[model samples]
Target: MPPVPAAVDPDTLTSLLDGRWAGLRADIRAEMAAAPYRDPIDLSVEEHRSRVFDQLTALAANDRAGLGFDKAYGGGSDIGGSVVSFEMLGFGDLSLMVKAGVQWGLFGGAVQLLGTAPHHERYLRRIRDLDLLGCFAMTEHGHGSDVQHLRTTATYDPDSGEFVVHTPDRGATKEYIGNAARDGRVAVVFAQLTTQGETRGVHAFVVPIRDDAGAPAPGVTIEDCGPKAGLNGVDNGRLSFDQVRIPREALLNRFGDVAPDGTYSSPIEGDARRFFTMLGTLIRGRVSVGGSAGSATKRALALAVRYAELRRQFATPDGEEVVILDYLGHQRKLLPALATSYALHFAQEELVAALHDITDDAPEQEQRELESRAAGLKVANTWHATAAIQAAREACGGAGYLAENLLPGLKADTDVFTTFEGDNTVLLQLVAKGLLTEYKDAFQNLSPLATVRFAAERVLGAVAERTSARKVVDRLTDGDDREALFDRDWQLKLFEDREQHVLGGVADRLRKAAQDPFGVFNAAQDHVLRAGRVHVDRLVLEAFVRAIARCTDPDAKALLERVCDLYALANIEADRAWFLEHGRLSTGRSKAVIAAVNTLCGELRPHARTLVDAFAIPEQYLAAPMLS
Candidate 1:
């Protein structure tokens, strides 16, 4: 927006992170080598899921496995390092990545984050060792994203110091739970907590599903979900508890606790806050998934780039079928996504770091902030991964569609990303709500109009800054001055303001919907979905802008400029309506934006390989050669 920073180089960001993935490369490669190969899409619903469980077991068996879990409990080391290893799994296979995620990220992380020290010591090591495979049983058949109203319950009893778990109906049973059938010996089940006739909201519990010999535990009935559109290597299932009873200690007593005397107390006040805090622990796992999605995008883009470099098409009179990478259209389709891979990688590093700091005994407020960051990054990265992988697949023409080529398979696995770990659309709505809440609290008003008004004032300030500033960055750099270009604070302001604007727009839309319940629900769907996407896009752009600012190399800076240019233009063009509606850009400026995108595509053509090369995904990891 502010004369796309001239000096910021693309390679600068790559070097800034200093190859954090280097140390994990050997383990990543070895895991890829040792990992079993399974065609999830080719199996029967039952066999497919069975294979998924087996794969999970196989991954857990590795000594270097569970790197992301608690080191004291049979894990490798740091959660950050584990994430690095998980991401690289995409290079070998997507199903393995996904099945492993359900196992460790969801199932194991639930125990790690939601469970207390006692629960962790008692069951976590077994989970890590695969002696007790488990499922994260939260989503019910009827309620997927709406977890608050789940129909299952855990009622405390002083008679035997036990609580009864029951799923009153079909919808109440947990559904679409990974690793639930055939393999799981335990489950981290979430059910309403009721003590002394007072019903608290959703709480997590550790429930044993099988005996030592792997037989179904008493009163728990598990049914395999059979099959679905994607993620076949996951043994998804539904479970119903018929008056199932377990010790009162089964509840994960980290955030809240229940004594043997049936007294319940939580460090957090209010039913709503307690529920949210428990759910807030999920942010780390979501952030971890975002990192994995980033890897998926890289793998897919690498495949496309390699194929494009070698696959020739119609050429000029000079007589050569032009390499697809030579085509401006292909560059337009692929290079920005390649740049996004960079953005996602750096942002993920930041998110992981933020998570580490907040989780390391920081105050509650800091933890909440980390959760928000995790939410924003998770929403942005997953949506980008799904879209990028699909685009990369199509960019390869036919080969991408073949299973052998991997893109098609990768796409299938990533497709579920939009739905699981909180639906992309739903997640953005939550982010919008979070932003609106902050706006109201910061400004001392909850009204949507008040929030919008405050945001409008902020925008005015930004516009004034744009008008009166000394243009500190403009004087700093001219043509391809990547460093000074990235140094401009205006770009960061643009991102901040853009997010606020979109969030305000969503609030306004929600308010309008309140006027008529039915009409608003129907109309708000598309409007809210759009706002959510815009917010995520702004995040991606902000990350790209920040990374570009950190670059020092001249050539990488130039290439990064091309990348940033394409990313900015492409995003703005997609949201032409917002620009026009808000008077941010005239029709002529919008046309120029489109033209700028085209120019960027041409400028970045030769460097497409160079840009992706910076992702540093080895050829062996890709299982294919560049320009082959």
Candidate 2:
């Protein structure tokens, strides 16, 4: 958006892109450089499982698996760095990312965060070193997004000092659990806690799924989930515990505990709140999935951009064929996506940093904010990854259809990212709920007169700042000067106004419909989701802007501003109807937004390869033929 006083610097940008990442990336890159990690073939599910498992084993043997755990448990205690390195696996294979996510991020994380000292002392180091393999069994056959409704039960026996874990019915079976099918011998299973003939609530317990020799433990029935649409290398399985008993101490009691006398106690008194808080402690999986999906999108763009440069198509009048990339249509298809990838990279990095800080020592309120932010970004980034990867697949033409190209694999694998890391729809609702809760709280602590005044002020502010305000921005800038329209303040105002309008409007309608909370909320789900999307869109642009401001390299700074502007305008263009109907943009300005996007695409086209090269995916890991 700002004036560029210097040329683009790809080297500086790439180096800066890799800055601050811990050495785990170097180790991952080195491992990927090896033949086993670089295979591009389409192996069968069985073969694929073995490959991913062995890869996890190798990462563990080299002391690379526990970078995020507490230092007391042999981890580096670098939560953000661990996630940063984990996402790099996207450069290699989706299966590896999912497998490692299951092994470390989910299963081990449950023990480390939910379980108290004894559980950590006994299991953390072993999990870190791959001395033990475990599954995170939370989702059930009947309830995927609603974990509180999961039917698995852990009934306490005071006399015996043991808990009998059971799947009361087929619906209680844990579904799509990574590591359960073939590799896992232990599981951190989420089940309703029952004592003194009364159900307490859903709690996590360390239960043995299989014996040392890999056979199902007594009363534990495990079934393979079978081949999937993609990422078949992950041996997802279903588990049902038929009255399997374990020591009472097997309960992960960091958040809740039961006494030998059959009394239930928890740090959090409320059942529903306690369930969510316990689960929130294990939210790292969502963060890592989002980052990993972002990496996949970057790799896809790199592969496609490189291919477009090399694979020439229709010839000119002079009989020499032109590179497909030179065509406006092709650039339109890929360049906007490249811009989005850059925006997400910055947003995800910011999220990692924030998560690291908040998870380390922040208070409960900040942790709640972290949960909403993580949920929103994870949904937004994964959705972007799916769209970007699909566009990339089409951009590569028939070559993308080949499994070895990895775009298809990336699509299939990352598609589930939208659903698995808390289904995107549910996650957005969580974000919306957080926003609404905050709005409610703001008005709660004031006097009636103050509340009414606050309410009226907010109302008047929204009305003034709504779509009508776009005309003000337009009048301030020279409509013909694309640079003027792309101003950072202009972009921020536009995005922020859009979010405010959507959120404020939704808040009003929901307040009016508050009589039936669940029904009314369900009726307004679409608007609530829109509110969530706009908020995340605004955050992404803000991060991109902030990152550019921090850049010392002038050329890189200027070039990155264009990337940021492209991201902003492209989003505005995507939802132009809303902006136009709401009066946020005049017809001419809306078209200008599209025009600006094309202009940035053409300007950035020359640096496409270098931009993707900045992602620094090793050639071995990105084994697509086009890259070669």
Candidate 3:
């Protein structure tokens, strides 16, 4: 059915992971090597930050910054290409990637996305050239996720015709701002804008935070956050502004604006609409994070799987030692993760395509849909990186624990990804809301007869799926129908049906929830998250299937199909409890799934090196001596 799964052929491996941009990645890698970015793992926070600053300066001098901006401001205007390169940068040093992202993706991006042409014309070229280093000042001590409640205020002064920005209390201090401690000269700060005695919600302003010689400006207080668990190379710090004044022109007034005379105006009418629209422009950050996380997952899986190939454990009766990977337990931990790493890789590529579509002038609704998808995938991929990296560490045993192995660093650095960009939980809640919103919209315009039919179909579909699941589980012929059991169509169908069942149940529950609103929604958080996971899982699998379908070579496609099958079965095995509870999997069928997964792992073990080799990490950056 899957054209007889074949062994991986090294000749076609790169095409599998590169998606549609192997050349672009190669070009980026070459440019990165020419720049000769260094990791400098042993430097202290201060020393490391200084070293990174110097590296960034070198990059800026090389005209390597602002890769995503339009050519008018000295950038290449290739958003997809830029993100591809940024994702590859993660394979080297995460701190460097993050610091660069801080400068280019967050700080510079705020101006590029949220600001009008004036902000770009006056500052972007200098920002790209490193003449004006800026920090994205958004997250505050008291308000990380709940930014709507931020206490920082930028009140307009009619007489002075300026915006006076102030942190009302210590809690309003900007925390964990990259480049703020030492190098950044300016900040794109977000604060509640007040004019004519009315708050106009959160807005961005370009304000100088540091003056000549890197000193805090007149009313700005700066403090180094000191050593962190990882990414010590970044100069993350806290800042508080006490009545800092900036010209009215400093406002990045694309979405909303304050007139020179202190009057407020915006094309968007509602406060909520304006807020979301402004943040939507910054969705590239989430997209970039997902891409980077996918790359990081590949690197870790490659490093660990390669080590497992060479590292020997207990000897067989013939006095020949077993390659640790020969053990079932070892393969269980690493191989499925290997498959998942592949899944994330494909999902990230799909995200990039969706982003390109939006950038190419897709409708506003399409852009919002992609934004929600990006948020979900960002959460999924980052969580995958965290899990995959940890599994890689454990798979390698003691050596993996050593810093030189790279697992230690990968784990610590990626752990924060689950929190940043948006907490995974919060982001999932967003996904759930989107799904629920769509569900409501679907039913909104239905005629009375059509509404009844729709409701009847949903209810009957659940009943049919439940019945079909029981039959599927009972008919599963253990390993005899192994080929049928692993059918891509069947596997995908089961996953989708399960998702449909869950969504239908949740929709009914949420309908009842409309009364209490707050209490019901809060109580349904776990269900909401389940819906998000199932949705993401479906997206990942769909992407994997489509990628497999596009493979030009036979051997590569067959082997990748196996990996895809592994990803499918591994997830099925992990969620077997849910399947069983829902009558989608019988005990025998579930056990068969486990056996099939183990078999797939053993089959893939021979190709482990080839799999990781496709990651194509520069040996210098990978620099894990054990890997060599």
Candidate 4:
């Protein structure tokens, strides 16, 4: 069970996982140390990637590459182990982390999830060994978020028993693809499958990009996307296929199959269902991205907090270079973000575990539920990561801008996160669509009397939305006295209120638009998307609360609880107008939200380093001194 109301601790939380995993984490750090280039901004794109591939080769050689995979794939670790190790890579550099992610999480995972037994036997080891690097060619220039609209097509030829893959025009070319510029021998290209005039939705094809001689394959056009704002170490590029023919077996037939006679069959019947199932496989990538983003944010905060302690500015009357952390403004800027970093870290762990559970044993619907959760978590965490890193950089002043300090590179590298895997806005819209479906399902289950109950419940749900911080404050200060209402539950509920209010806002808007559905949907896409984002935000907050409750270490638990409070408080204050407009909180309570957040920021200021330290990043991966 999770720790009780008042005794939550951080050390207990970290202790839930085996500390021996830190050894593999250390190996990754050593691999990073041995890399040719430590700072990517200082190296040309080719040089950066060349060095990254070299480092990846070293890590793969040492058997550190398979930690989170199955033993059959030469991995000795599980999902938690993989996450712990991958998060540590952020301490070295974000670009290296992305490149490593592509190699293991994408290429290897694609084979594991989408390929059959023979496919794995033929390509898994090579992918793991880096003997045959590959890129996931799913996104297209004309249809990034809309995977169903891709123009690339694969037509089957029964006479030759081959699939002719072609990107008919420039708009259909795969772009922003990692590992496409150099070293990839094959790609898991997604294209429309057609046979006998019946076109199936997107399917993954193992298309060879380079011949055995390491030269470009015929009919394949690969071009570099050039130097990007971040992840320079990744060979992000564009690929266009022109009637490229591959054997019938090239199709990843795990869920669907293509026969020698040009017949295509899938257990999933609908074109849309098959497409969604394929997209669901990418949720693991989203989870990994969330964890990676959290790790990077933690590293940035650690650097900024440590520097603030030693590097001082104007002092008090006693005459001393006061530590920047001594200023409330500095704490305000960095501490809450630090708190959010902690929440995201714990939340990501839970998401990974939840995904592992469903993928391993749950039914199809359960797996889809987990998939939605992963998508939601990805949107919430990554968006927060960009904001958190920027805050950490600004808190460090000019030192942060210096490439040597790692902040500028960290910022540049992480900038793409909000877009990669899925754009933040697009993903949130997906989450919104999911929420709408869920609501409709729940509403449909109601009978005549239950319909009245549902109506009443909806009114109550709208009326009782509570901000997380206020919940905590009420518990902490409930004696009919202002301070007596400062209960932990009150603080937690106050935090929950923010989420409920936002969701209610969307519900209210949609309810009003029930009269003109198209106008509401067409004109209010942004609002609908925002509502979906709010629902996702609520889900993440709940997960974070649950994870902290599960931590065993008392002090760590207590600290995490405080961090959770800060995270919720900051968000509530940031969106106070929602609470006010919804009649959930008064203007006075709204102001109280800001004051409480500020106060909590001050309380967390002292333990900021301790919170990030609990992450246990290896020394070499630590990047710099976190404290004087």
lDDT winner: 2
lDDT of each: 0.71, 0.84, 0.83, 0.73
Ranking by lDDT: 2, 3, 4, 1
Better of 1 and 3 by TM-score: 3
Report, for all candidates in order, the number of backbone clashes.
10, 0, 0, 42
The root-mean-square deviation over C-alpha atoms between each candidate and the true structure, in angstroms, is: 4.8, 2.4, 2.6, 4.2
Tell me which of candidates 2 and 4 scores higher on TM-score: 2
Error of 1 at 501 (Å): 3.3
State candidate 1's TM-score: 0.86
Per-residue lDDT tens digits for candidate 2, residues 198-265, read 88789999999988788999999999999988888899999998889999999999888999998988
Please state the error at residue 168 of candidate 3 in Å.
1.1
Better of 3 and 4 by TM-score: 3
lDDT of 1 by residue, 1-628 (tens): 2332433343444455435555565555555655545444456766766665666667667764677677788776577676666666665556667667767778888888888788778877877777667888999988989999999999998888998999999889898887776677888899999998999889998888888887788999988787666776666778889999989888888878888888999988999988988898777557767877887788788778878888988978989678888887888789778766776677787777666545546776777666666777777778888889989988987777777677777787778777777876678667655555654553455477866776676678567554533343233334443333333353445445556566655555555443575686567667666655666666666766676666666556656656666666666677777656665555665576677667667766666666665665555556642334
Q: Candidate 3's error at 133, in angstroms? A: 0.6
**TM-score between candidate 4 and the true structure:** 0.89
Which candidate, 1 or 4, would have the higher lDDT against the true structure? Answer: 4
Stretches > 4 Å off in candidate 3: 2-7, 32-38, 441-461, 464-480
Off by over 4 Å in 4: 1-37, 441-485, 495-518, 622-628
